[model samples]
Target chain A: MQHTDNFQEITHHHDYDREASRKEVIRVTVILTVITLVELALGFWLMSIHQELMRHFIKGLICIFMLAKAFYIVGYFMHLKHELRNMIMTIVVPLLLFVWFIIAFLADGNSYKNLRNKYDPHHVEESKTKVDKPVHGEEHGAKKEGAIE
Target chain B: MAQAVPAEQKWWSGGKSPFNVEYGKLMMWYFLMSDAFTFGAFLISYGTIRFSSNNWPDPNEVFQSFPGLGSGYPLAFVSLMTFILIISSVTMVLAVQAGHAMDKKSVIKYLIWTIIGGLAFLSCQAWEWTHLHHEGAWWGSNPFLNMDGTKASTNFTNFFFTITGFHGFHVFSGVIINIIMLIMTINDVFERRGHYLMIEKAGLYWHFVDLVWVFVFTCFYLI
Candidate 1:
């Protein structure tokens, strides 16, 4: 008789636990919807101010906004926040480094492309300057058509 | 009479259960991480090319979807694609919730909804691709095409197709996987366990797919 009563009590407790988890799931869904709506609004707002922002801040603000949305998706939806710190660190630290690398590469690559354009007359005047005058007269100085070879 | 051999002595035991998530989940995590690096590489390469060229067409202009059959006003369909994917993510979350509660009926229903959303997103992407292809934009064949129909750059179209094409393949695979899970759920394979780890894992991958798109959208559309 005692075993039967204990079994009933355990089953009832399990039922309540499942119900609570269901409610939590619904709460999470609502939260995600609200955040995504906010992101949608922000996207439009940025577009409206794009011209002014581009001139003053160079579109970096848009990139920052994108990262913010990404963080919310990963941290909340993916539950990375509840994960072990080591696992979180493993993903986050490397991603941060990679992002920095991309930015550095873009900065350097753009500067180099600019420098090449300024010095390389072939890219600037490819149609008019048919005669290939090696700017430095070096073997590698042979200019290719339409910019970087 | 022989001494009893414990089940632990079996060759398969090896200190782990096959489906208790010891190896499966860990392997999934590793696969996802490597896949992420592949995406990162593509995006980084895209950045390199974008920075190297001048007079490159603004993504906002290039990605504008052809507005009707001949409306002459290109629309930003990428935003619509983003919205579809986000909605699919929500359905996926609901399916995971149902799976956790061992509600096989709701799990199957939500899985079907998620699959439908995936297919719709794929169709929209197909439309976007066909439009780009018709514009004589062979991958890397031309850098740029001016508004007046003159060629601008050859490098532009190359990266355009490569990056987006790679991401599309991931989405296609995701759709297929979800379909399989849906079928399995309907056939009562997952019902045996009273809990669906497969759905949870699929949800993780599906959410990652959405996450990747958000980055792709920002890079190739908004930027």
Candidate 2:
């Protein structure tokens, strides 16, 4: 096969500056690390909290941090920010679908749970009743059999 | 040829690459986009099930053990895994930068680091899985109880294994890809091709794997 020498001709090239690029990489790396450290700290803090509202709020904040970390990785490490606007749009537009996807699925799931709680008393009762010891593997199965008998 | 074009030349015209990227890179982006959805679906389903359940196991309780640390250290081991992946991603970016400069040696060096990072992450995951398995967590089994000590569903272990296992499969493939890139770099394939564009494509993939981990880590460990 003839290796086309026009490989450079069809592709658009960016001017390379090693020093500026290295500094940018280091900057992004530092940002990513700091964000991750903050996230870890939040995760630890979350362990101490028991309030439902507060827990939800902290989880939301962690999700936001996760998105920010994603932005840095894609925008810098993956070079999506440097791509042509047309390409960026092609990638970003489809991702918007996830918002609706998440909302609809979660809403439906919550509805299902509400319905189950109202109708399936057995499931609700079983889930609410605390067990003395969490059973495992064959032991859990054996206990179920004992209960059945 | 690119320089000869007028400054205001339409990028979307039939003659030019619309994204100003080579076809391989464009296709790789599209592929990653599709893969993002695949992972997104898996995670969304997991969320849906968790929402539908009356009670669920706490992630902190489930993933507290570290190798040689016995237990009780919540979020510690997974955080280490997260940093490993992040550092590997940095090395991947450096490799791609070196590729852009046609610096073969630097490219090789960074690629090796990235591969080691990938391997290290996989090993961490392996230890975590083995530890969980020893505790009787697997598909269709849950030795753990809900946060309130109520009976927990098997779905907890089910989704954990499936999603993390899937992500691990991606990392495993990524490591293999880097190895292939390393072998090519060693044989002077990119050197002869006059451009290290292939490395750039592989870099896109490596960074994407890292991107997925950010979500996986948050969903499984943090949230």
Best by DockQ: 2
Best-matching candidate per TM-score: 2
Fraction of native contacts in model 2?
0.56
Local error of candidate 1 at residue A78 (angstroms): 2.0
Worst 10 residues of 1 chain B by lDDT: B14-23
**What TM value does the first chain of each candidate achieve?**
0.52, 0.84
Residue A14 error for model 2, in Å?
5.0
For model 2 the local lDDT of residue B149 reads 91
DockQ of each: 0.15, 0.47
Estimate, for each residue in B18-111, the C-alpha lDDT of model 2 and write its tens digit: 6677878889999999999999999999899988988888999989998998899899899999999999999999998898888999999999
* Worst lDDT 10-window in candidate 1 chain A: A135-144
Q: Report RMSD (Å) for each prediction in the order shown.
A: 10.3, 3.5
Least accurate stretch of 10 residues (summed lDDT) in model 2 chain B? B1-10
Q: Each candidate's iRMS in angstroms?
A: 12.7, 5.1
lDDT of candidates 1 onward, in order: 0.65, 0.87
Cα deviation at B92, candidate 1, in Å, is 0.6
